[model samples]
Structures are given as structure tokens and as C-alpha cells.
Target chain A: MLAFLLDPAALSGPADGASDMHPTRQRLISVATRLFQQRGYHAIGLAEILALSETPKGSLYHHFPGGKPELAEACVTRIAESSLAAIDRLSGSGLDMIGFLRRLAEVTAAWLQRTDWLDGSLLAVIGQEQGGVNGPLSEAVRIAYQRIEMRLARWLMAEGVAVARARDMAATIIAAQEGALVLARSRHDAAPVTLVTDMLCTMVDRG
Target chain B: MLAFLLDPAALSGPADGASDMHPTRQRLISVATRLFQQRGYHAIGLAEILALSETPKGSLYHHFPGGKPELAEACVTRIAESSLAAIDRLSGSGLDMIGFLRRLAEVTAAWLQRTDWLDGSLLAVIGQEQGGVNGPLSEAVRIAYQRIEMRLARWLMAEGVAVARARDMAATIIAAQEGALVLARSRHDAAPVTLVTDMLCTMVDRG
Candidate 1:
């Protein structure tokens, strides 16, 4: 296996060493994630991913035995971890939970701006594509959402909201963020991201 | 050109009559909308559309000179008009604005229950796909959203909310629905849909 470079965010997990990965596998994953993010999943091909990664066919399969599906799973897992870490880091700050949420809002707005509104979260793309089909990718999508939802729920609980209300609010918070991204992307303005986040934060705080 | 069997929901628009349509064009639009909504825009092929619609290849080109893009535009427009009518009808029931919104929540829930959550409002799909892309599709998406936002703003104004707040709330409410649908689709549950609409309705009513 090529050496997998540990993402700073993923370092908290058990795989502390860069020992396990082949360099080509790491390159393949990074390239796949960006391609999948820009175009819908089915719209892309293995050759494109391999070419983009500059890895040979044998090396590509050498790491991901399951081919495209395996690579996709790895990409989803990596992206999910990175995203969760960012959210956790923001929310884990010493500030109050509401303040943490506000900070998250800012990060999300910045993300929309930085990507020029083209980057819908990877889990989201998978969620939309596999929404109808029942498969591992779909499961991966669910697990990713659950991770975010659980984290948000915990933050809301820390803020003293009821468990049920907190879960609902977390879901609403997510919806607002996702929808705001859609709007910002379409409008080419990050203004909606900020506005939606503020309104949701207000709703959470008022409760 | 096959005759369009008018759906009351579809026909409420300003250009409702089959008298106005070239029969083949009407059939193509109706067939394309169903296929696109059921199986996504890219997954369905032109041959399948022509076969199912019983329209010849020549007629398809005659109607949609720009081919898939043109057909896609027609589908978006038809669905957009149909959606606006549905929203209008639901919001126009003798119920006040709040009541109308509440019923809309229920109606939407019922609608989701009927389909396998497949035929999402087309505007929402276009909104996501064309959000950051500058093109005719993007403009059409923006205009469709503007229409929804305007109707929602009117409802909020009737509820005695201040104008600016109403507009802000209108945008947020729309965002919530779009976002909530994404969430609901991800989780394969109507709960998020109900939760978002309920929470927003309460938020609006309290204000």
C-alpha cells in the first residue's frame, strides 16, 4: 500500500502513522474527491480519475481492490472526516455553543465563497445521486449525515435545549446551511449563506 | 403531435390550452418532464423519450431545436409553472396565510408519500444544478425561485410581519423547504420535512 498522508484533521483517529498507504492511493483519492464534487458521480469515469491523479491502472487497483466503488467509499469517508473535524473544531472552541454555531456559519459562508459556490458537499452529491438506489454509497451518505447531526445535537444539548428539540433544530440548521449554499451558488453571492445561518442561529437561541 | 391531456394543476397557467401547443411538442414536454423527474435528467436517453412519447425523431427536433438543452428548458418551465400553480392553489384555500402555509406543509408531506420521493419540484433540482453556473438554465431557476419568494412574501405580509422581515423570512422559508427536502431524501424520511415546516410556521406565527 502507498503511504497515506494523514490529514491534520484525521490525525485524532487511531491511524497516527503514515505507514499504511501507497502514495498513488492517496493521490487517487484526492483527485477523485475533487472530480466527484464538480460533476455528478455517474457523469465521471475511472480513466478521468486515474488521469487526474497521474497514477497508472495497476497502481489504482493495487490500493482500491473494489475499483470505482471502493475509491468512492474512500473519498466519501475522507471528505466526511475532514468536514466533521472542521465542524467539531469550530464548535469545540471555548466559546458558548451559540457562539460556536455562529462561527460555523462564518466558515460555511467562506466555503461557499472560496469554491465559487460549485462545491456542494461530497456527501450531498452522493445523497442526491444514490437517493433512489439502495447501496453502500447510500449508506455512506447516511453515516456522514448522522455524524454531522449527532455533533450538532450534542452542541444544542450543551446549550441546554431539549434532546428532541435539539435534534430537530440540528436538522433545521443543516437544511438552512445546505439550502443557503444552493442559493449562494445560484446567486453567486455568499449573502444568503450569512442570512440563513443568522436566522437559524436566532431560532436556536430564542428557544 | 399528440394532444396534451391537460392536468388541472398544469392548465391553470396563462397558456393552458392545447389549442396553443403544437401537438408533438406538447407530448414531448409532458413525457420528458415525467422521465426526467423519475430518473434524473442525464440518466434518461433521447431514444427512450421518443419511443415512449410516440413522437418521431424529426418532430422532436422540430419542437426542441436545441435538442436536450431545449427539451430540458421546456421541462423546467412546465414544471415551474405547475409548481407555482400548486403552491397558489394550496395557499389560496380559504385559510389565512398561516393556515395556508400549514396546509402546504401537510400537502407537501402527502405529496412526498405518493411518489417514492422521486418527482421533487423541478425548480429545486435546477436550482441546485445551475446555482453557480451562468446560463439560461440558471436564469430560469432564479426566476422560478423569485416567483416562489414573491408569493411567500405576500403571504407573510398578510400575516402582519414587517416587509423586510417578510422578505427575509420568505427566502429563509423557501431555503428551509429546499434544504429540508435534501435532508429528507438523505434520510429517506418525511420527518425532516414536517419538522422544518412546523418549526418555520411556528417561528413566523410568533413574530
Candidate 2:
């Protein structure tokens, strides 16, 4: 069942020191992100991350002093930032609110298909897995979600929606999308996300 | 970090053979369901469940000979049944769709508060956790969501929503609520769900 880890391109990266994006440190985060996303925090071990990222334990400790949780936090933060960037890109793509929502849903569907349908957001998976169970990680997860909600609400306000409605819509959009992704991932299908987007666009039009 | 396992109400059951509800087998399911809901499938071990439920190895083996996955599947099924029953009860209540959603959100919020906000569903936590990782469990989760969606759609259709629209609204309501729960757990707060409920009620009204 763990056969999903047998990625052919997993080891194709440089010998740990050649990444122009972030060197060995970034490599570890990228691989760990995917591993944690594919499996989960408990199911994954640090040794597996080292092996997959082609990094040694010494270097791993050097980068992430708190070990697995620390590395996982970095992964969560990374996912949060990248997700916000995606939101900003779509928000500013000149699409109307409905069009933006459709584009966002399509992008998420494409991502689910691209990742072998693993998942769309690491924070979301981790948040659900760790929430109320892991205190410190849950705090970080909460902050990440809060930031996304804030940005989403702000974007809606810019679109001429009222402040309160914008905030409510933002909350609704995030919850709907995340929940739809969970349903979609279960069936290995992306139809749920698109359907939710259609429903949300109708809501937006009414607003 | 694992101190959350220390539930005061955990061991109050009538010692093994005294449960009028389901005997030792039912007790085992109740305990395991909470454990799996708080932590994902991989994070929770059989030893913990047995220890907490006060069940011996032989009894556990007698009921769930297939071990962890089997027990987890049972938990998912129980949650699905209980959840659908709630949906049915709420649908049958004299409340309109708006009042129905408000009551649903309030009930979920109270559940979160009651559980110290651990989470409200084992299937959602496990679905997000095991979706792309574990094939059998994912299929089970998919079936449960489909059942809930079907029932929800039927209820809305009874309430005068068009067939196709009822289906979309049901999908939207499920996604929004599940996603809202994840957010709520992160902060040990229920506001996200309530806020999403408000937004959903409006969509529901417009429909």
C-alpha cells in the first residue's frame, strides 16, 4: 500500500547541494511536504524523509532543530504561503468573482489529478489530522487558516462586496472548498470541487 | 502531548459484560470512534484502544479479527449512521431550511464544545487523513459521504428545491460544514462553522 512512495523522479534531484531555489534545506521541505501530504504526520518517519530528500540526519537536524514537528511546521508554513500566492494570482487575474471561483476550482482539480490525487493543501490535511490532538501544531494550523480567510475576505471587499458579507463569503468559500476537496479525494474524483464552485458562484451572484 | 487521551468519562462503562446497549463490542466501538476522531487512524494504536476501553485482546480479536482497519471501518459506519439519523431528525423537525441549518450548526457547535472541540466526525478526520493513502478506508469514506449527500438532497427536494439544485445545495452544505469543522478545531472555536452556516442559509434561501 505504501507503493505510492516509489516515485521515479524522487531521487532525480541534485546531490543535496545544487538546488538554486533553496539548496538542501529546500529539498528536504519539498519532499517532506509531499510525503506528509501523501501519508500523514504519524505514518511518516524522519528517516523516510531523509532518504527521500537524499539528505543526511546531521543536515536534517541542522536545518530543522525540533526534528519532525519542526519540519512539519515549516511544511505547513510553506503550504500556507504558496496557497495565498495562488489565491492572489487568481483574485487579480481580471476574472469576476464567479470566474475567479471557477478558475480556482479548476486549478485545485488539476492539482489533485497531478499529484496522483493525494490532496490539494497540506495545511488542510495536517489541520484535520492534528487539530485538537496536537496543540502546538494546531496553533500554527489555525494561524495559517486565519491568514487565508483574511486575504479572501479582503479580496471580496475589493470586489465591492460589503465588509461583513465579504467576511462571511470568505469563510463560506474556504469551508466549502476544503470540505469538497475531502469528498473529492475519497472517491479519487474532482467533480465535487467543481460542483461546489458552481454552487458558490450562484451564491456570489445572489450576493 | 498525548494527555488528551485521559478522558474522565472514558472508563465509566459497566466493566466488560454489563453494557445493555451492545455489551463489550459496543463499548469498544464507542471508545475507538472517539480515539480515531481525535487522532487519525495511523496515529492511534490498538493497544491504546484496548487499554482505554478495558477490553482484553481475545475479546477484541473475537469481534474485530481483521484488527485496526476493521475496527476503524466500524467506527466510520457508526458515525455515518448517527449523522444521518441527526439529519433525518432535523429534516423532520418543523423548522424551515434556514432554521434547520441554524439548528444543525448550533448542534455541531455544541458538540465541538462538549468534546473540548476535538472534532465532530471520525469519517471526515479519517477521510482527510487516509484518502489517498489507504484505498479501502477511502472507499468507505466515499460511500458514507454519498449516503449523506443523497439523504440531504432528498430532504431539500421535499422542501421545494428543484432536483438538480437540491443536489448541488446538498453537496455545498456538506463541503462547507466539514471544512468549517476543520477550521473550528484548529482554534478550539466554533465560529467558523456558524459563520459558514449563515452564509449557507443565505444560499439556501436564494435557492
lDDT of 1 by residue, B48-70 (tens): 99999898899998888899878
Cα-based lDDT at residue B144, candidate 1: 65
Q: DockQ of candidate 2?
A: 0.59
What's model 2's lDDT at B37? 78
Give the poorly placed runs of model 1, Cα more than 4 Å off: A1-20, B1-19
Candidate 1 local lDDT, A1-207, one digit each (tens): 000112323433443333375677767877887666655466568999888778888888889889888888887777666666555565566777567656666766666666676655566555666655678887887777777788778877887899998888888877767766656666667666667766776777778
Q: What digit string (tens of lDDT, one per residue) describes model 2 on residues B69-136?
A: 88888777666666566667667777889998887787778777887877545667788677577667
Model 2 chain A weakest lDDT span, ten residues long: A1-10
Candidate 2 on A1-207: residue-level lDDT in tens?
011112324322332233464578788888887888777788788889999889999998998889888888887766666656656766777888998887777667877787777744566677767857666776777788878888888889999999988877887788778777777787788887887787788879978
Query: When only chain A is evaluated, what TM-score does every model earn?
Result: 0.84, 0.87
Docking class of 2: medium
Each model's Cα RMSD: 5.3, 5.7
Q: Estimate each model's TM-score.
A: 0.85, 0.86
